[model samples]
Target: MKSKKEKGIKYFLKKLGPGNHYPKAILYLMLVFSIPATVLNIGSDIAGMGAVSNLLIPAIPSFVFSIVFTTVLTITIIKFSYQQIAGILKWLCLSVLLYIIVPFFIKVNWMDVLKHTFIPTIKFDQDYIEILVALLGTTISPYLFFWQATMEAEDVKHKIKAVVVDKQMLRDVKTDVNTGMFASNLVMFFIILTTGIVLHGNIKDISTVDQAAKALEPVVGKLSYVCFAIGVLGTGFLAIPILAGSLSYIIAETFDWKQGLDKHFGEAKGFYITIVISLAIGLVINLTGINPMKTLVYTSILYGVTAPVMIAVILHVCNNKKVMKGHTNSLLSNILGFITLIVMTVSAVMLIYFSLHH
Candidate 1:
């Protein structure tokens, strides 16, 4: 007999997706509302801690600069096309390596660290595996996908609404690859920042999403948690809407329903209904009160397991002339993307094999 908890987890996993546009108003409200409260709350937590030693930690300004650079790249994507996005992403991947592998040179016995890092001794890897599994899991993140796809839809609808009023091809909503890649990099940047901070120094396990929320405080420092909270919680509002919306899009597209953001809410009842159901289900995830960190870990592992097929689909979509048209991946982009694909595939296989062996 399945427990009520198992049933809730099943429901949350099954429905979270996005379809049309993420409700911007909701995201704005969350950011505006959460920052002050989160800051005050963090202040209270800090005040309770009996030492100034904890407060001594500082956010590496270089990390902040990197984030800013990523944001600029995002702007470039929106302004340009897929070709430019690929060039930027290749550079970003190089930077990603720099971020991961470079910092050890500052203090550690470089040769000894390299011995441990490259040799990958079995005992050391057991602790490392969980974090790697969690981080790699980002590839199939439903929140980001829902955000990207629905934002693509939002771009389309914005253009459509403009066309309806002005009667010209004011904008095109053809799922810009640059925009998608830009968003993807930004996400990867933050995850690396979080994981790199902990994994390189602390090497602790983050078994949940709530822990992720807290980890930022130590990394970024101070009232910035409010900003972090706003970014996440606010984004969650956007994410949840997309979560709901993706399900709606998939359902509507499947049934050939008249589904689009351009349609009024009243006219697109099925779309709205699907969105509502998805959000309600996600809300249930929090309310059911399972440890969010554990929920996030399990979800991450699931995503890591499923990522290879998703990568193949992405490559196919990028390659298909009918889908991507002039924005097909360049040779270098294709090569690097394939490398990323292989790495993820290998990781998935390792994870599966380890599970089975255990």
Candidate 2:
């Protein structure tokens, strides 16, 4: 299912009906929330590191402006290939290992961890549900779905020769995706464990950067702050580009405008402009004096609220014989997909109910 250019989820949604605009609009809404969320995340990381180091970071507006300017300059002017970007991300990903190491350094209740791992506790209160939804939203983000689909399409299109879709290729794709998901979740698990164990009683709310960095201090001492700061900065740098690129791909594909990272600014003006605009909007959001950490939480909650609909659409497309041909979802895939759909739907409903009633 390779084409000459990247055709994202929007393209697949188009195949369902030429005139269907709702799905496209829903996607646009998701990106609208995602861009500012990503910008806020990056800004928070920069601010966090500065505070941890006791370096006088520029004021929030100037700091945010500098980040936007640097990002725009790097993406637009330098023109780094996807391979180079991936290489940098590989190093950044190692920063997650810091989280993994933290649990080993601190005392942990292994029995409790194992028990909770198998049987998670349930809570219906608004605060608990909100955090639960945010966790779900961040972990299974909608943008990742777009990013993976577009990048895979781009990869096939850029190949010199037509790539064959064989069993080996399918297996490779499965392995790649599985490995990535496993690693990501593992890092997240350790991060939660470290924070919950070390900072649970001491810090009631992690509203500031210093509070966040303190989770690592029990193990790494002063270097713990530095380590935490570096990890945040690294992951922020890695994620911001992909987040912007994913939004750009969605817009370009929906409107049938020219799009590709490999293309020059002059060649794909609309695509590049979309990226620039999204980043600019994110910058504007940071200037409004909203708390970055709170913004991140809200962003994740927004992702959670919209996720079930997106998942339903994906399940529809995957099961449709016309779209997948012989590559339709297997029984296991369908079962898991439905379970996710039901869980997310229930969570979102309860969240709404609790927010209004509580």
- Top-lDDT candidate index: 2
Q: Give the range where candidate 2 is weakest over 10 consecutive residues by summed lDDT.
A: 49-58
Tens-place lDDT per residue, model 2, 1-358, is: 6354335333543454322524567666655655555555544443433344442233444454446544754464227666666667677788778778877876788999999989998987999999999999988887788888776665555542423445665676778788998999999998788877877777778876566776557677877667876676666666767777877887787777878776787878998888777666665555555565677788789788877877887888787776566888999999999999999989999999998997
- Candidate 1 regions with alpha-carbon error over 4 angstroms: 1-127, 139-150, 160-187, 194-228, 321-328
Model 2, 256: alpha-carbon shift in Å?
Answer: 1.0
Please, what is the TM-score per model?
A: 0.54, 0.85
With a 3 Å backbone cut-off (N, CA, C), the pairs that clash in candidate 2 are: none
Model 1 residue 87 lDDT score: 48
| Ten-residue stretch with the least lDDT total in model 1 | 44-53
